[model samples]
Target: MADDFADVYARLRTIMLEAAPAMTINRDEAGALELRMPGIDPKTKQPGWFGTVTTKKSYVAFHLMPLYTAPDLADDISPALAKRKQGKTCFNFKNVDNVLFEELSALARRCAAT
Candidate 1:
């Protein structure tokens, strides 16, 4: 079955919104998408931690951040997730698991709080 990144992103956005109804999500200028939660202090406001599932002609890439704003988080997840494609990181699954989705939502919430 062929996979579409835009559809995947929309599903993820829906899941995130269901998890945190107050959160806002939209695509950025670079065509990358972003999510933000309400009530975040303006001074501390920052883009929510995000994951990307990019589709290439050959394969799909699942770029997840186990932690954001801290390099160690990416480092920790990278080793376990490391499989390269054209010198880039990729994930085998077409769809992410429920646990990962929940974790991503949690990370977004945490980032919004700060």
Candidate 2:
């Protein structure tokens, strides 16, 4: 991971934990950090959310999967996600901004609550 990506991930992890203490943050088999709330299922659940922060060759990417496949989410995040060149539900943040981080944290909290 790039240094900036690591920094952003650390900041995001802190923000997320602060907002939703019940959620768990861990590394997946690919070494990407997976943020998940216990008891939430991506399938058979109304709101199943998960996210990963990754560092690719050119940029740092944040991929968020919103629960329930809501078009509202795509509509809401389309501007920020305009840079994506691959994947179904991915958002690329060239630089992590307060607004984006806060929105992500809010989403995490909302998903955890459901």
Candidate 3:
């Protein structure tokens, strides 16, 4: 089970990294991966959030903050990916879905540009 989650996390993390090459890596480890725009937010005094892939107990989470700020990005989401969404910005998964991951990769690229 843990191995499955690790594989899922790895694949999702790769999509994020490949899609958003300009973003800064906030965390990269077995349990979590985060990417952020390269600057501090005046309001929060922290880097602007871009996305994250995190391993939770039951599943992994892929979060794209741009989806929250730029609703248009959601327009590109497929129903398959939509079923995994837990919130405006977060998608949870128990296993890897290559089709969904490809869609997610495209979304991340668009998000990175915004």
Write model 1 residue lDDT over 17-88, tens digit each, in one string: 454445555443222434454445457686543444444454444443323344343343433243331222
Tens-digit lDDT track for model 3 on 20-50?
Answer: 8999998888778989988788999999999
How many residue pairs collide in each prediction? 0, 1, 0
Provide C-alpha RMSD values for all models, in order: 6.4, 4.4, 1.3
Once model 2 is optimally superposed onto the true structure by TM-score, how far is the C-alpha of residue 67 displaced, in angstroms?
4.1
Model 2 gets an lDDT of: 0.57
Report how far residue 36 has shifted in candidate 3, in Å: 1.4
Q: How many clashes in candidate 3?
A: 0
Please list all clashing residue pairs in model 2, or write none if there are none.
Answer: 48-67
TM-score of each: 0.39, 0.59, 0.93
TM-score (C-alpha) between model 3 and the true structure: 0.93
Q: Output the worst ten-in-a-row residue range by lDDT, candidate 1.
A: 80-89
Better of 1 and 2 by TM-score: 2
Better-scoring candidate (TM-score), 2 or 3: 3
Residue-level lDDT for 45 in candidate 2: 70
lDDT of each: 0.43, 0.57, 0.88
